[model samples]
Target: MADAWLVVIDHQRIFADPASEWCAPRFAETAPVVARLATHFDDRVLLTRWLPGTNRNGSWRAYFDKWPFADRPDEDPFFDLVPTARDLTDRPTVDVTTFGKWGPELAAVTGQYPHLVLAGVATDCCVISTALAAADAGCTVTVISDACAGSSDENHAAALQVMGLYAPQITVLDSATVLA
Candidate 1:
């Protein structure tokens, strides 16, 4: 098996539930792929949940204020990971308030690896943010294209293209290729 860490981002009910305002259309298709990737990575997987905190800085406070519905309580089902992709491994999950997972708290978890395979919801948002940060942290990042869903198909493809521009340090590939 490849000695790469798998980072699954924001595959929670708020983003995956079609009924929710934050739903990503491709989540249904991406969930199973993410699950399979998580299973393959096993102990090397790190699942990230975007949980907005009550306290925010500047623009983040305004951003959350504009979308008050997103201020979900900690126990709300909206914050939980989708059933199809939940708890597949014994590894601890990292929760961040921002779009990127490479925040101070996650540095220790991510710094241990030199290569990372990224997956999950909103390819244009959290997924891309995390991927770039991973590359900056000196990790070779490979994004599983089919395993990530964005707000729209166009945005998803655009983000992939942007990441591709990063070249050797960050590449876009499918789960089949990575798993193989």
Candidate 2:
């Protein structure tokens, strides 16, 4: 696990806070596990925030229209890393507007081909997106199942199953197994 880079994707207040309309039900429960991953991965961890994209062009225009609440300025506390996990890693937080954060920002952090151990919120959405893209880009990805929260339990399970189809490229495991 020494070379594994942990990417904590979109573990932000919007997904972790219970009062948010888009909150993931298990966000709080999963956060501690992610924090533990950060500690284990140390400086190799990259914590990400889903900031509303300024380029509201193309399909993204409709995306923002569907979730107007997220269109707030980047400074909004709603987009901040959840307080409990804020200091989990000292690496600069990667701010991405796209659901799949496997672009230049991430590649710059871990290089072109990295062993990415993924964790964080909306397992059905952001986590799944990042996993698939990174895997497609020739990086081996391991998703820490227990360390991710989704919009619902069913969705989380479904996403894990989908990712498992990628086999060797993307392997989903619990935190205990991953940390071991």
Candidate 3:
């Protein structure tokens, strides 16, 4: 697994909290799998948090306007990684303001790895976005299906199918297969 890296995307309190409007269903189940993956990867594991800024442009500005509740306070716990999913590794956590983690900040750290195993919340959103960007960046990407939670089951399945067709470099598999 020397060339492999596990990237855990947006498993934050905002998505894990059932009361939150942006909650991702089945986060309770997804958390354990993410934790296990972190344990398996140890130093090779990297976590990403979505940190939206006050300033926005284009559709993003409209998006924020539509869902003002999505604007979390700077110090809100909603932005933090889920309790059980935190502290699994000592690796630095990457924070991004977009749906994908393949931005300049993350690219600099992940470019060295040839393979990336991804897990986290909203499988149809951030998970898929990051997977595609990673593949485009020349990394062979594998998305841990069961370890990811989406807004709904249908969306999760559809996103995986969409990602399957997006590129040959992206593969969707269960965590057990990758961990084995």
Top candidate, metric TM-score: 2
- Where does candidate 1 stray beyond 4 Å? none
CA RMSD of all predictions:
1.5, 1.0, 1.4
Q: Write the per-residue lDDT of candidate 2 for residues 28-52, one digit (tens) a residue.
A: 8987898888889888988888888
Candidate that scores best on lDDT: 2
Writing each residue's lDDT as its tens digit, candidate 3 over 1-180 gives: 566788888878888998998898888998888888888887888888888776678898898988788876656777988888678768678887889887777767767446888899789899998988878778788888999999999999999898888556998889888788
Candidate 3 minimal-lDDT segment of 10 residues: 105-114
Q: Look at candidate 3 and give me any clashing residue pairs.
A: none
Return the TM-score for each candidate structure.
0.93, 0.96, 0.94
lDDT of each candidate versus the true structure: 0.85, 0.89, 0.84
Rank order by lDDT, top first?
A: 2, 1, 3
Clashes of each: 0, 0, 0
Q: Which stretches of candidate 2 lie over 4 Å from their true place?
A: none
Tens digits of per-residue lDDT, candidate 1, 35-121, equal: 888888878888888998767688988898898889877678789988876666666678878888866666677564468888987
Give the CA lDDT, 0 to 100, for residue 175 in model 3: 85
